[model samples]
Target: MSKYFAVLLLLIFSTQIQALEKVTLQLKWTHQFQFAGYYMAKEKGFYQEEGLDVIIVPADPNNPNVDFRVLYGQAQFGVFHSGLLKQRLEGKPFVALAALLQSSPYCWMVKAQSGIYVPRDFQGKRISLLGHTENGELLMMLQRAGVNTDSMLLYSGKKPFDDFIAGKFDAMQVYSTNEPYQAQQLGVATREICPKQFGLNVYADVLFTTEAMLRDRPQQVMRFRRASLKGWRYAMLHLEESLAVTKANYATHKSLAQLAYEAEKLKDFIRVSGIPIGKMSAAKWLWIAQLYHLDVSQFHEHKADFIYSEVKQDPASLSWVLIIAAVLTLVCIPMYIQLIFSRKNKSHLR
Candidate 1:
């Protein structure tokens, strides 16, 4: 009995090890508190609880494209921005899982001394911004404000914030949760022209995977999404521990104060009053797609598939269980009848 028990223990351990699914998550940028949920998921063993061995890959100079990595299968999952919607419209076969940030964090930052106060003020000024697809909210804000985006001088800079400070560019794009804090630390007084002011709301830090992954491994996707959301909830609720874990392990470059500032600012975007964390509303998505000028028919056709839903158990497996149960019942009925008749015969003999 002891030997058999030992064998059983070994088997259980081996089975658990085998059951762990090894997966990779490609991050949008370098390690920071922006990706706290993912870090917490891995750190707090939430991923492990879901039978996942997740490798959180941070963006570096070489590996910067999260979407390319995920779509090409280099990474099983990725965290990206609403820019992913345009790619999906272009037939990229991408699926958005959750929007960690319910509101857009992207904004154009200018020194307080700079006369640029609004999107309209950006006209005829040197601006550092990404492509229209990448920073559509900003562009849309400019357009809505009656600024001809094409007429404005735009360029991408390697050190945009520094350039803005040096008076090279009138304004540079920044994240409300991140760069504002950095500028504050550097003693630079800055003002942000956020898109939300113009009612152009976009989601950031979106978790997503490919359609192929969703279709082929729905259960894995469901488990990963569930665990990731759980991590997000925990991280939001336990900001101090999340900051400590991130500083000590993941983003050492950022000080605790800096992480805390980011955490505090992001709470407004992450935890809305009525909305659930990581919940993506279909109405908001349709509005975003409309902003991109995508085909309404196409958006409608792919809408259901693009948005994620819970994966149900396979019907084939359920049918197999029923078949086995029916067979067992059929086999037992005969034995039960024979036993009753045998007992009756024995009574007669008595």
Candidate 2:
């Protein structure tokens, strides 16, 4: 009876130990190749291996605010653009974990026949930035090129892309990886005035979480980062497989061919000059801060805590400790039970 009881207790402890920690990841946009790494992570058991059950929440177009979701604790982690630096400077306790895109995918798209080859050419033109009120990179690019952003006629209305296709706007902001391919499918010959071309490059699709999570659950943050980056490496290497996983599950809205195009364009951004995917440098962040005209001294002050550092703890050590505790409990409990039985028997015999 004692042996069975011990076994039951061990089973209960094992069940408790095997239970995974649940966490939510808020995406910056709808399910697509842009978030393929996260999809692959969940699909390939990377998160499971890290003892995590990650709930990937795709952004609703009506409520597309990844930063808010994470800040308010609706999600533990989120993906955002370099605008994250702007938020950080605003006293938000956010920490950047990884920057998946070494180069910003944003660019200004114009009809090839429009003769607008550069940012300077955008002066006095009707521009639509997909209804975005804040895009510092593009505005900075135009500003540097001597174009008054206020001088340009800005369109803020529904279906900006359709309006651009209809020749209602001279130029519109676009994702080099996504919109260009979309335009190609529609047989629209378009040219992109990418910020990178003018040497105003910045990071995109940065994985981040609030500093509280990093402080309170450091191990979980490290595990999630490890698994997420591993998933990104795998997705980069096996693009076709990742695309299949994304389409079959997360991004049924995107066609394989379109995903393939996005993957192709994203390769340079993801794997820049053999630099490891998701690696970030303080120098780069500071440069981005300078571009945003934020207080560089403030960034310098908080950067130590803003960037991620690995928590040096062995993943298997905790498991070993738990196993040892279970084994000790199993043995000691039965022995104690046997001792109790012996005492009771002696009393009865007496």
Which number leads on lDDT?
2
How well does candidate 2 match the true structure in TM-score terms? Answer: 0.86
Regions of candidate 2 where Cα sits further than 4 Å from its true position: 1-17, 130-134, 314-317, 320-350
For residues 15-106, write the lDDT of model 2, one tens digit per residue.
65577789999998898898888888889999987778999999987877669889999999999988888888889999999999988888
Measured by TM-score, the strongest candidate is 2
What C-alpha lDDT values do all the predictions have? 0.84, 0.86
Q: Candidate 1: global Cα-lDDT?
A: 0.84
In candidate 2, the residue pairs with backbone N, CA or C atoms under 3 Å apart (3 or more residues apart, or in different chains) clash, namely none
Provide the lowest-lDDT 10-residue window in model 2. Answer: 127-136
Q: Model 1 off-target regions past 4 Å?
A: 1-11, 61-63, 155-158, 313-350
